[model samples]
Target: MTPHELETILTEIGLSNSALARHVNRSEGNVRQWRKGVSKIPDDVAEWLREYHYFFQKNPPPQRKG
Candidate 1:
């Protein structure tokens, strides 16, 4: 996926670069590289993100009983 596409997906999912790095067990620097197109986003990672994003969109987390 393109950097812009990644940015959109992250925005849609409310995930910051640091949070994505933490989730994938990568360094923040790596995530930045992906975000900036300095490094290519792996196919597997991209597909995984798309799948989870679709799932998240369809089945949002329940609101807390505040």
Candidate 2:
């Protein structure tokens, strides 16, 4: 996904960069790079995000809705 899309997802998911990095088991620097469009998200990280998106679509967090 594009950086803007990723940032929107992150906001929709109610996660800051640090929280997202922790959730995805990636470095905060990597998350920052992704958010800034400084680096492309790796395949594995993209897959993880997709999976997370799938689960989230199925069962969103209490504070968020479709």
Q: Candidate 1 at residue 35, lDDT?
A: 93
lDDT of candidates 1 onward, in order: 0.88, 0.83
Q: Give the top-scoring candidate (lDDT).
A: 1
Lowest lDDT 10-residue stretch of candidate 1: 43-52
Q: Give lDDT: candidate 1, residue 55.
A: 93
Instruction: List, residue by residue over 1-66, the lDDT tens digit for candidate 1.
Output: 999989999999989989988877788898899999999998877887898799999998889896
Per-residue error for 59 in candidate 1, Å, reads: 1.2
- Give the clashing residue pairs of candidate 1, or none: none
Candidate 2 local lDDT, residue 9:
73
Model 1 ranges with Cα > 4 A deviation: 63-66
**Alpha-carbon lDDT of model 1:** 0.88
Best by TM-score: 1
Which stretches of model 2 miss by more than 4 angstroms?
Answer: 63-66
